[model samples]
Target: MLTNRQLQILQVIVDDFVTSAQPVGSRQISKKDWITFSPATIRNEMADLEELGFLEKTHTSSGRVPSEKGYRFYVDHLLQPQIIQADEANQIQSVFKQQMIEMEQLIRESANILSELTTYTTILLGPDVQQHKVKKFQIVPLTEQSAVAIIVTDNGHVENRLLTLPNGFSPSDIEKMVNILNDRLTGVPLQELHLKLEVEALEILKQHVKTADTVIQSLLNVSTGQKEGKIYYGGKTNMLNQPEFHDLNKIRMLMDLMDKESQLQSLFKPKDKGIQIRIGSENNHMAMENCSVITAPFSVGEEQYGAIAIIGPTRMDYKRVVTLLDMMRNGLSRALTKP
Candidate 1:
């Protein structure tokens, strides 16, 4: 319900604070060539904005800063979609062109490029393995009692784990087990393989009882317990350079959250293809209350796959971040699809 003048004043305050990282005063607003209002009138509008929870005054100063709510409103209402310049697009395209051979390399390079471009920590979630069908599985004997199980997914991703065999199990027996397992369940998704193994285990115990029980348990444990979707992070130290993270405790909390990739991934669970912006305090994590997250989901096909996000202080350059992220997502999708 803010008047047009009030909204204009609020936009100026937000834009100035985002650029300079300083609180905006009515005097500064009045001095702007674009603002036609007098200092008294602008100050009254700012006061009304503060009362409406869109602005906050720091200390005893007359200067005002946009609250998290104000930022949310501005992004949802006042902001327009920004266009990426040709030079920026060229730089990103060059990076993609250089690393188009491998998916992991492409994602890693994208994360690095994004962090460098934005000067903020960037996280790229690798593609989900559960949705990928198993291309191949092999059991290689390492020692008399140990074997390495390697599973390759349809998307060219590989996972390996060592399995300890029963004391008397021979290498030949392990090979036999591998052949049997692969023959029965090679092309299925790893998640489905786990379920199929559970059902087969009961039948195998009732029928083949002694021979398949031990092998079934070993294969089930290795395949089903495999972890997937690693998180790649870059420019973690960049957070410390922001004014909001000058506090040691704040930096520590952010560092800890970054270190916990599982938690960070959970924080940005996929929610469709569009960009999502989480302002300060909207995030459930208490440590991230002063920060903002800008994320966009990407996919290999019809199914939504993974996401990339930029983390910065709440006063971050939203227009630029949104523009860059949207472009990055499209670039990443194109890079991933390239042969």
Candidate 2:
């Protein structure tokens, strides 16, 4: 446990290093408006804090920098939300309020805007449509031999496919099939639709629809698509602009990791519905040992969620990034899911 004064000094050191990416000296810390103590007194406290494993010196005779432990402590205890100005908030809001024809384009733009705003690498993890629960299903008849299968998830995400009805299947047969699917599978997850169709819904289809097995197979194929999800990235080159990433080897590590979308998918681990912060080595990935990962999750509807991940040097402006992601997730949920 830290005393009030010690916590204050640590907070100042963290905030200063996060901005400047430099070792903090007592003289430098003393210049802050809140530090009324003399440089000598603050130096004594710094030594004590170092002994307690919170700070480390980069060189034998250099000033102090926060160790991974120190950063973890600072993130867990000393961080606060840095409120963005109204003008800045409005600028971000403007992007979402504009109705774009495609959610994918809106997400792409959002990633770019966040990276520009924070000067950090940002990733938007799009929810897997394969996992979204069914909200409604429609069978639009184009002709006696053809129709379209439209499935809407509870989150408002939609997937559709052109389906050809087998010969001898009538309009009445199509209605019966749609009713049976909606009755048995309205709340079923997309990933499980195939099994549900085969086990229960298909049995009902076999009884009422002619060439029932064939038509049922077509509906199942359309309902359970194989569309793989993607990760939207902003500022893939932005981290090169950060001082902490000056090492070419470190830059290569990040580049390689980002190149693998499957690895990027495994990088995010949100504990609950709240924002998650992983400082330096805490992320448990070697490539991320010198980086910090911050995430905020938002829901579109039942079991459908996506997140904003900001990747930066360990000396990240935690206060600002956290607040920005919080605003972004909420705004995105509203924009995409609202009627």
lDDT of 2 by residue, 88-180 (tens): 798789888785435666677889988988999999888877777887888898887888888877755677777877877787887888888
- lDDT of each structure? 0.79, 0.83
TM-score of every candidate relative to the true structure = 0.78, 0.77
Local accuracy of candidate 1 as per-residue lDDT tens digits, 1-339: 889998899899999999998889999999889889899999888999999999999996779999988999999999876787798778778767773155666778888888988899899897776666676778787787677887776665666776776677765665666665566666787768777777853364435334555555666764455365768887979999999899999999888888887798788755777999999888889889999999898775455377898999999889988888888889887765543
Superposed model 1: Cα runs more than 4 Å off: 135-152, 159-186, 190-228, 337-339
Deviation of model 2 at 104, angstroms: 2.5
Model 1 pairs whose backbones collide: none
Shift in Å, residue 88, candidate 2: 1.8
Residue-pair clashes per candidate, as listed?
0, 0
